[model samples]
Target: MSTPHVVVVMGVAGTGKTTIGPLLAARLGVPYAEGDDFHPPANIAKMSAGTPLDDSDRWPWLDAIGGWAHGRAGLGGVVSSSALKRSYRDRLRAAAPDVVFVHLSGDRALIEDRMAHRQGHFMPTALLDSQFATLQPLEADEAGVAVGVDGTPEEIAERAVEALAALPEPAL
Candidate 1:
């Protein structure tokens, strides 16, 4: 079992994908893709206005992330996305079978705190519940780490990377 190069940093809003994704990618010597980049203009506007997006607004963004992750994984890159629903993850897997989804778990209060502290982000704190409402924790069948983010950013990232290290590499 070889280690998968494709990884998604996931969780509800404010779980720190934006914070840790780049560091992880740098450690792995791969470029990191921000999931927000794939969002349609309308979707961005909706979120920017503190509106929660329904599945209809999400499918296209998820598909784009799927495509980007698959393409990058084939070339040994990593992506960070908040693929909230199981169906979304499934859609992503359809494109990037080799992906490992790293789940960043934390309490609503903590996430809310982080979101409140964050500045100049399009995602409003008001949308936190919608994010939590949509979030589906990673399952046993998924290949990845699920770290509880009730600690420092370094600790959380370290735990995730440590977990990733423990996964046996698939035979090349």
Candidate 2:
């Protein structure tokens, strides 16, 4: 039997991480975790106030998510995280060595429009630029797929699943 991978649905704000992660998890028959739920109140407050978080503010949040990923390791699961920087992804990989990422990619204009229309979310449209500036696309060596976000959430999740299937399985 093939090993089940813990999938991290990643992208900038409004790239549909929250929306797609659960669908992807459902498709994969794994539990889904909201990355924002891992953040401390302070981090949420900072972002809610239109302030972008620095590395220091992110470590704990990343650690919390990492811990959850670590626990879900072999059993398989899905989680949503912005994971904008290479270092942040590295931290997650360290915790769950076999985890794979599904990066929801899209142009700035579309993402900004989505953010503007979304309600009750902590991240503001004002922070969208910062998110783009911080995003570092997955490198060649990373065990991940960059799926475009130009379709409905179900379509995007389907693309992600198809892309993930194309990846070479990790060596034991």
TM-score of each: 0.92, 0.97
Error of 1 at 28 (Å): 1.5
Total backbone collisions for each predicted model: 5, 0
Query: Which is the leading candidate under TM-score?
Result: 2
lDDT of 1 by residue, 12-110 (tens): 889999888877777666788888888999999999998998889989998898888878765656677888888888888898888888898888998
Candidate 2 residues 69-131, lDDT tens each?
Answer: 999978989999999999999999898888799999999999889989999899999998899
Which runs of model 1 end up more than 4 angstroms from their true locations? 1-4, 170-172
Leading candidate by lDDT:
2
Error of 1 at 122 (Å): 1.0
Candidate 2, residue 101: how far the Cα is off, in Å: 0.6
List of clashing residue pairs for candidate 1: 1-169, 1-170, 1-171, 2-169, 2-170
